[model samples]
Target: MPEETPLHERILDTTEQVLRRYGPEKTNVVDVARALGMSHGNIYRHFPNKKALLDAVSARWMHCFTESLSTIASDSKVAPAIRLRRWFDTLRETKRKKIQDDPEFFQMYHTIAKELHDVVTAHVAELLQQLETIIRDGIKAGDFHAKPGASSAAMAFLQTTFAFHHPALLVTRVPSDDEADTVFDLLLSGMIAGPVSKKLRPKVKKS
Candidate 1:
């Protein structure tokens, strides 16, 4: 006798692949069930409808991302600098597998009413807030620059340097982890560049 595969997990796994390839519009229960080697009727037994399945998948993804971030933040064995770097690194990595890459996702959902779009945007906004909290803590500890407001600085850094999300902005002959670390250090410290000193500007002492 064949072991029964769990319906919810199968649906979500299928949805991930479908979102990457086809996006939301083409992600019907029949297609997902076909992917899982099950009948469409069987899939409906797990999820009431396609929209319910889509919403559940999106929610589950959010929980996973948040859980991962929370675990990293609480890991005491990691040094603060390494942890800080990890924060940006995780953001970069996540962008590679993001909602934006799923064309069918955007296409299918965008065609719907604005409510769906608003929900997606709100989810992202919440994640941004969670990361900003970490940045604020770093600032308070004097490890990160706190001049330009922690939230603003964190958003700027993520938006500007996260290569996975904004690949076009990432200019470099070599894009390695070491290279990224060096670049990030320069950006963070160079932000606090000191003012030019008039006395040190090749000035002759007045008699």
Candidate 2:
């Protein structure tokens, strides 16, 4: 006997393929059914409408993003800020390149861009909170600031403060990796009074 599969899971897989190839607007129940070799009516049985299918697709995208970021935060060799900037740059370049290289993907992305931004930004804020915990730990371990409640200050830091101000976070006019590191350090300077952020000013060298 063969393993039985669920209708919803199969529907989800079909929708992902549809979104990648055709994008959100063009991906409808009929197209989804065609991709899965099933009837249009059958797709409706699992997902009430096109919106429902796209909703599921967005959720899957979020879960995949979180898993990747979580892995980076766990790497023992890398500092929190370094790992974060790498991932942040990777994300901005990936999206910007996708838009530049593919028109259809670009259109599909704009259709869902606001929704995607909300989901991604929330994850970023969560990552900042994780970084805050690391910084706070360093403070308690005597590698950071001598001031009391310094750890709490790091926890209260705003995600936008670094993200908007830092060149590393910009999708447009992305600086070289070296420039990005400088920018990351600048934003982190005043924010971190503890061990990790203690070096507020690294002398900038001009070429």
Pick by TM-score: which candidate is best? 2
Superposed model 2: Cα runs more than 4 Å off: 1-10, 20-22, 75-107, 115-129, 142-173, 194-207
Model 1, stretches more than 4 Å misplaced? 1-6, 17-24, 33-48, 58-66, 74-80, 93-119, 166-179, 190-207
- lDDT of candidate 2 over 1-207, digit per residue (tens): 112247677778878778887767677889989988988988776678887667666655445544655566556466655655655555445545544576454455445645666655665566565555545554544444523463355444434334432323433443455765666575456445433444765667788
Find the 10 residues in a row with the least total lDDT in model 2. Answer: 164-173
Each candidate structure's count of clashing pairs: 1, 2
TM-score of each: 0.57, 0.58
Angstrom error at residue 150, model 1: 2.6
